[model samples]
Target: MFLMMGLMYFVVDLAAILLLSACWQRTRIRGFAIVAASYGAGIVARWTAPLAYRWADSGDGGMGSLAGVVVQTAFFLVAVVAVVGFWDIYRVLKQRPAA
Candidate 1:
């Protein structure tokens, strides 16, 4: 259960990596960097989860604190940006002739 929950956190980053890989030429290093940052954000957020739960109740009140909120916000924002960029790149790659 614990391992499964932990894996769930990286779903976005993993998908972004795979998608960016598919459109490698279109995204290049920038896409990879974005995904890597997102992944890093997730790692930080998870690392801070203990403090978040301890302060923010570890109850039901969103299960987070200020630190948790900041880290989680960063993670979500970067992950979303990476995924969107990858999707757009993939679309462009599919439209053009394969290089």
Candidate 2:
């Protein structure tokens, strides 16, 4: 069940990335590009951190190790960037004149 959920999350993330990329290209919107790139980075980090944790667990005999710390830090930073990108998008929309 967890595996299926993970697969679904990856699919959805990929779809979002593609859609955002298209939006960025079509509209030439910086916020869209920033959000899409941040998401792409976050996806890579999301997939990589687990493997790093597993490797560290095998060697260190626990999750409380450097890998876990790095992963957590990366996740936090990525989340911050994602939020900022979203905020920028909101700002852009709010500033635009409605047609």
Which structure among the candidates has the greatest TM-score?
Answer: 2
Candidate 2 ranges with C-alpha deviation above 4 Å:
61-63
Best by lDDT: 2
Residue 84, model 1: Cα distance from true site in angstroms: 2.9
**Tens-place lDDT digits, model 1, residues 14-93:** 67556645555455645555555556656666756666657777567765556566666766786697696566656656
- Local accuracy by lDDT, each model: 0.63, 0.82
Residue runs of model 1 more than 4 Å from their true location after superposition: 1-29, 58-75, 91-96
For residue 11, what is the lDDT in candidate 1? Answer: 76
lDDT of 2 by residue, 7-89 (tens): 88789888988998899788776778788877888889978887987788777576557787899899898888878878888
* TM-score (all chains, Cα) for each model: 0.46, 0.79
